[model samples]
Target: MFSSKIVTFNKINFLNKLSDGFKITNKSHREYFNLGHPLESPPTLRGSMVVEFKMSFILDNEEFFEYGSPVDIGGLSAGYIGLENYKASDLKVNFFDFDKIISEISAVRFYERQKFLEHEITESVYGILKSNFNNDLADFIRFDENPHSRLFEFCLAGGYKINEDHVQKIHIPNTYKNSLLMKRISDRFKGRVLTFNPKYGFESRNVG
Candidate 1:
């Protein structure tokens, strides 16, 4: 039953067909990055920018008490809706390798290099190519920057570089390819993503 559907939310925008509701300053990651540092981090899962909707569904079925409780403003907007046929398997990442990289790199070098690398990457010299990929992932997790593009930009952020050749070699998993909801404007996913309404009940559109 839980596997069949997932809940998500969006900001009300003039262009949104289902855009309706009062906006609130949820302490999610989008605001975390947007608001900058020296602030208390909100206890929320998934930042606003990464998934423009609440993803408590990820923890909904856990046996632990209130695992997914106190989600922000659910059912408040027409744009606030549920996704049908959601699956965790659809989301993939080589987190094992990424976590390994995160652990292996020296803290000094990781923090110092803040610029994206421009050189071509090969399998043999992949480890030598550096631009703080680990720290960038940390920022992405803490902040709501658009995800590092797997194709064109290659780098995780400005200096965190990963080329096509090295990406395949390292087994850097494509995380968002099959996700039903990513930033719709980013062109990361094609079309046919669906949303459900809580108002009149249900309506879906191909969000391209």
Candidate 2:
């Protein structure tokens, strides 16, 4: 049962998705700095960005939730509609490991689909990756499942430096090498490299 999925949408877009019945299980701050990124610059400074998080578009429509992004959106996204809890906050302050701050802020939760049989979690998760990020930068963020620890394996992996809104360019990280889950699109990446926590793309969220 996939309780939640990773997503990237601003508050306005998020509200629209919610109008379509997408419930937010949790969310990550749209502001983040990739590892090795100078701590002096965070995400918020770049204005006109979207809100990204873990979400599930299922209330009574589980089918809508499952085969939508990969099948319907057609590689426009990746990752399971997972969960995270990040309240409204200011995206300033720099020169520190944001992993610590994000960890402190996120109280992740999943809005799983009803599971009838016991399927291997890895395949399902991996499948989502392949469906969503088959051709893109799948080698970037490979931290989805490690099998031992059950938590949101949030890592600043591979992403793009899109120049949107003209505020400046942004580093939008993909989830992994298999799936560039549009799960999280942060304005943070002024870049992605370096691991403050030693383990960058090794763990995963055990949603069982």
Score candidate 2 by TM-score against the native: 0.18
lDDT of 2 at 50: 25
Candidate 2, residue 170: lDDT: 22
Q: Which stretches of candidate 1 lie over 4 Å from their true place?
A: 1-92, 106-112, 116-208
> Per-residue lDDT for 96-172 in model 2, tens only?
32223223222222311111011112334433444444323222223323211122221221121122221122222
For residues 1-208, what per-residue lDDT tens digits would candidate 1 score against the true structure? 0011112244333112111122332323122001001111221222211222211222221221111100111221232323223222222223243333323332225222211111112332234223323434233222322211111110011111111111110100124323443333223222423332222122211122
Collision count of model 2:
28
| Model 2: lowest-lDDT 10 consecutive positions | 111-120
Each candidate: RMSD to true structure?
Answer: 19.6, 19.1
State the C-alpha lDDT per candidate.
0.22, 0.24
